[model samples]
Target chain A: GAGVSQSPRYKVAKRGQDVALRCDPISGHVSLFWYQQALGQGPEFLTYFQNEAQLDKSGLPSDRFFAERPEGSVSTLKIQRTQQEDSAVYLCASSPDRVVPISGNTIYFGEGSWLTVV
Target chain B: SQQGEEDPQALSIQEGENATMNCSYKTSINNLQWYRQNSGRGLVHLILIRSNEREKHSGRLRVTLDTSKKSSSLLITASRAADTASYFCATYFSGSARQLTFGSGTQLTVLP
Candidate 1:
């Protein structure tokens, strides 16, 4: 793909319903990340993956929030029992594989999946 | 609180004026990045400055980093009304390699 791609640009789910957002990272990129951005706020980290292995998920707000990058190319963020507070844009970003942060690979982001729990 | 915090929650400027936004981080960072977002749109990467680099310029955008002060600034020269958007600073924590912590961001409005 030309850039990070996300599905269901907008979603409306009833409270307590489950919703799934998909992301396809840029081709050949080795690092992928997911974030949640509430209105009027910056995007917050949700999880990170180095290849297919999930290295960090401490930022996931609760047990209901889960993300996985199955092939290290495509990822999915699933929210179970969505709440009103969960209404926000779920962002998917990817970066080239770099062993260290100082190496500084640019992180590209998707247009994001806007989820609104009514 | 997030690792990074941006100053001036909101900024209003006329077109052709220069706009500068600041970011402060609490901990050492490997690199700092700036992004722009328009209403209801995804973020667009502006620039990234490494800890070792004091400054970097790309087109009309200039970025400065001060590791000692744990701060960075983004200066947009000759701003345009199309430049109206929210600006954010994200940091790669020295201890964390993959996670990018973002600040609250500054909403910049450039009036024509």
Candidate 2:
């Protein structure tokens, strides 16, 4: 793919329903990240992946929030028993390497999946 | 929690004028990055300045980082109507898990 791709650009779920969002990062990118952005706010960190290893999950808001990057190329963020407070835009980003690049360091972002919990 | 805080929450400027946005952070950071968003969708990376580097330039965008003050500024020269969007400042900590903490952002409106 030319850039980071995300699935289900928009999703509306019931209060107790479970929803899953997917992300496809750039080819061979070593780092993947997930973030949640509320209305009129900047994106907040959710989780990070270094290849297939899940290095950080501290940013996950609750036990219902889970993310996985199985093959290191594609990732999924699942929310169980969605709440109205969970309504937000879920963003996925990718970087070329583990260490920040001094010359051309930049992270690519997906269009994001907007989730609405009714 | 967000580490960066941006000033001038909303900016309205005429096209061809310059726009400046400021950001401040609490902790030591490896680098600071600027990003732009249109229609509240994906973010586009604008420029990045390392902690050791004082200033950097990319096209019409100029970024300055002052580690001593723990603050940074982004300047857009000769802004156009197309430049009307939200701009954000993100900080990357050296020891943290590759997470980029972002500020609330500044909404810039370049009127034609």
Candidate 3:
């Protein structure tokens, strides 16, 4: 089965520009998550979606960050007025279900979209 | 805030030797998961240990969880040069969504 996949493997954007990153979760996956990882740092949660509903956006660093999953399978993370600090690798992960324990639900990750804000 | 914290930011070991990494979390969790990432790419899930389980094993990977101490340890026995990578411990909090809070990770270098 195909694992999670992200588009635009690399993106270079000038400061104050807007960029949108896309994610395609595995077929039938019910849970999707977005994370931001700085160089040599662990991934930080950005947002979560179950089906087509966005459940948690608390991890989003600022209001400029927004995400949506309208069709329940594909998601997009949009950054408005990107800043130099936004330079990092954006990771996407998906799991079968959220109710199941972590041991039972193995979250698959994508190669990630690397964003460079110059 | 990040829930998990891994000690010993970096480690260097000879091939065929064992490597141990530890993680500590501030809050209670239902399970602890270990993941490996190579070259800062996607993370690969290694093992998961439930709060009730003291130890679990998968191939060369061994994970142990101690709820009383809010800490966990991942041990790799007979590590090979290919095992060199960044290892992370993620905590799944109880009652919350299954989202994982990952630690900074420990970079391991296995020299052949």
Candidate 4:
């Protein structure tokens, strides 16, 4: 893909139900990131991956949230036992090369997976 | 926790007027980036200013960084209705550059 792609653009999950959002980053981009944005708020970092290595998962809100990029290209963010507070847009972004936003590398974001917990 | 906080929580102006938004951070950052998000849409990267750089310009956007003051400002020249959106400032920490930490954001409305 020419840019980052996210699947399940919108999802409605009942409380306690689980949901999975998928992300396909730009080809050959080694860094991927996930963010959660509530209504009228800025996106917050959820997690980050450097290729297949989950270098940082410190930003995950709780144990119920899990993310993985096994092959270093496609990633999935799974929210288990979803709660009402989990209602937010999950954004996937990717940048070229080894790190986040070095000098010249630009980070591109997907349209996001909107999750509505009802 | 969020590293930056953008201000003028909300602003409204005419299409031809200029709009400026400011941001302040609490830590040493490797770089700061500005992003704009439309309602219910994704964010678009606007501009970036490294810690060593004081300012940068792109199209109608101008970004200024003051590491010593831990602040930055984004100025939009000749705002348009299409420029009405929420702007956010994100920081990549010098010690932690794996991801970006975003701010609360500023909602700018440009009336045509």
Candidate 5:
């Protein structure tokens, strides 16, 4: 794909149900990131992946949230025992190389996966 | 936790007028970026300002960064109806983790 792609653009899950969102970054993009945006708020950092390495997961809200990028290209964010508070738009972004914006390093975003946990 | 916070949660102006948004951060950053989102969809990259550079321009967008004050401002000259959207400021730390920490954002409405 020419840009980042996300799966299940909209998802509605039961309170206790589990859900998984997928993201396919641009070809050869070395950095991938996941963020959660609530209604009328900004996108909060969830996790980051440099290649296949899960370098940072500190921003993830809780242990129920898990992310993985096994092949260094496609990534998945899984939420177990979903809660209403988890309802938000999950955004996935990718950068061609390291995030040194001074040298024109820009991150491209996907349409995002909107999850509604009832 | 969020690193940046934008001011003036919402703004409305005529199409020909200019729009200005401000952002402030708490800690040091490697770089700051601006993004635009429409109708709750994907976000588009607008501009970037590094910690060392004070100002940068791209087309009609001008960005200024002040490391000492930990603040940045975005100025849109001659706004258009198409420019109505939510603008966000994101900061990338100067460490190993390369992800961005975003602010609440400003909603700008350009009336035609």
Candidate 6:
């Protein structure tokens, strides 16, 4: 894909149900990120992957949230026992490289997956 | 936790007027970036300002960063109705790879 792609643009799940969101980053991109945005708020950081390594998961919010990028390209964010608070738009982004002095690392974002926990 | 916070939760202005949004952060950052979101969809990257650079301009957008104050401001000149969107400021720490911590954001409405 020319840009980051996310699946199931919108999902409605009942409370306690599990859900999975998928993201396919730009081809050959080295960095991928996941963010959650609530209504009228900015996207909050969830996790980051450098290729296949899960480097940071500090912002996952809780143990119910899990993310993996096994092959260093496609990534999935899984939420177990979803709660009402889990309702938000899940955004996926990818950057070509890490931050360096001369080159700016600009991330391209996907349209996002809107999850509604009923 | 959120690293940046934007001011003027909402702003309304006529087309052609300049729109200015401010963002403040708590800690040191390697770089700061601005992003725009239309409706509730994806975010588009606007510009980036490094810690050493004080100001940068791209097209009609101007970004200023003050490391001492731990803040940055985005100025969109000659705004148009198409520019109506929510603007966010995100920060990346020095050692962090490319991960960004974003602020709440400011909703800007351009009246035609």
> Positional deviation of B42 in candidate 5, in angstroms?
1.3
- C-alpha DockQ for predicted model 6: 0.60
Q: How close is candidate 4 to the true structure, as a TM-score?
A: 0.96
DockQ of 5: 0.63
Q: For candidate 1, lDDT tens digit of each residue in B5-24?
A: 89999999999999999999
lDDT of 5 at B80: 98
In candidate 5, what are the lDDT values of residues B1-112, reduced to their tens digit?
6788999899999999999999999988888999999986899999888888999999999999999999999999999999999999988766535668789999999999
Cα error, residue A8 of model 5, in Å, equals: 0.4
TM-score of candidate 6 on Cα atoms, chains taken together: 0.95
Model 2 docking grade: medium
Off by over 4 Å in 4: A100-104
* Candidate 2, true inter-chain contacts retained: 0.58
| True-structure RMSD for candidate 2 | 1.4
Error of 3 at A11 (Å): 0.7
Tens digits of per-residue lDDT for model 3 on A29-102?
A: 99999999999999998998999999888899999999999999999999999999999999999988864654
lDDT of 3 by residue, B29-60 (tens): 88889999999579999988888899999999
Task: Give the best candidate by DockQ.
Answer: 1
Candidate 5 reference-contact recovery: 0.67
Q: Which stretches of candidate 2 lie over 4 Å from their true place?
A: A101-104
Give the per-residue lDDT digits (tens) of candidate 6, residues B2-107: 7899998899999999999999998778889999999967999999998889999999999999999998999999999999999999988654555588899999
What TM-score, computed on C-alpha atoms, does each candidate reach? 0.95, 0.96, 0.96, 0.96, 0.95, 0.95
- Give the per-residue lDDT of model 1 (tens digit) for A20-77: 9999999988989899999988999899888999999988999999898888789999
Q: Show where candidate 1 strays beyond 4 Å.
A: none
Q: Itemize residue pairs with steric clashes in candidate 2.
A: none
